[model samples]
Target: MIKNVEIRQALPADAPAIEALYPAAFPDEDLVPLVRDLQELAAISFVGLANNGLVAHAAFTPCSLAGRGDNVALLGPVAVAPDRQRQGIGSALLRAGLRHLQNAGTGWVFVLGDPGYYGCLGFKPDDDVRPPYRLPEEWRGAWQSLSLSEHKTPLRDQLTVPQAWRRQALWTPYGL
Candidate 1:
């Protein structure tokens, strides 16, 4: 396990380290452009550095409902270096990025991920809110949302995931 791990906003120099983690985390996927796009559009992106190098990273990108109804963000591709898994670095990076988004007045955040892990961080599936795309049965309960506004409004049934993310197959279920 790495000691003295520090979490901070991702820097331009951290791109290579961040890119390197993606393939290890999702080997079957082509993550080149996704990494580039996240770096470009992220409202908040964070990295955890250990003694050797970066060990974990997370990103949140701007998103909104169609017709410009409400503003939100998408949390995704949270990754930890292969050798660094289960050391709490991923959790730390996620918490830091989520806290930053909440403090920035972002009203809502959505994610498609493992419910077991994300649920512990206040992510939940609300039947009242649904994504724009069709998700698998198993994914329905995995789609989650977090509200940062003081007086939270019920999420619209029709989610409008960002257009740029729509082409990606992984985001199809979440309607990104």
Candidate 2:
């Protein structure tokens, strides 16, 4: 059973455990390197621990909108150990991580995740903020945003993300 999970910023020493969590949670994909690259690129990473062991992780990386000067971030690669799924660990990690970014003065955060899940966290599909690449119509709905402090100002410019996320395939669901 999931125990008292603590959420906190990830440290360099947590790399090995964080790396292992990715592949174990997503066996069909090789996302360890991507996550590592994000870490190397200075993404804000957070981990959830229970019994002093890493159980969940979430990463938020920098992104920009053409012609607009507000601070923005991309959220992805959130993972929970297979054994820890559906136990609220992921949600707790996300809430804590988002709070970190918001307090850091981030104006907005974008994510491509399940509407049912992220929607509950105040994320909503926003066609206004265009991604750098074209997404399949079927998956367009997955692009969502959450303005910090519940701001309603819509972003209507092309979004630019980190080099690792430049791959067109990365714009799809679970493409990390």
Scored by TM-score, the top model is: 2
Q: Provide the TM-score for each candidate, comma-separated.
A: 0.87, 0.93
Best by lDDT: 2
Model 2 whole-model lDDT (C-alpha atoms) = 0.86
Per-residue lDDT for 10 in model 2? 95
lDDT by residue (1-176, candidate 1, tens digit) is 23689889988989988898888877877666777877776446888988858888888878776647577888877888888898888887888887888887889888887788888888888576666667777778778988878888877755666555666475643312
Candidate 1, residue 81: how far the Cα is off, in Å? 0.7
Give the distance in Å from residue 6's predicted Cα in candidate 1 to where it truly belongs: 0.7
lDDT of 2 by residue, 1-176 (tens): 23698889999999999999998898987888789899899899999998889999999987889835669998988899999899989988899988889999898899887888899899999899887788778877788999986575777888888788887766668732
Clashing pairs in 2: none
* Candidate 1 Cα outliers beyond 4 Å, as residue runs: 1-3, 172-176
Clash count of each predicted structure: 0, 0
Rate residue 122 of model 1 by lDDT.
88
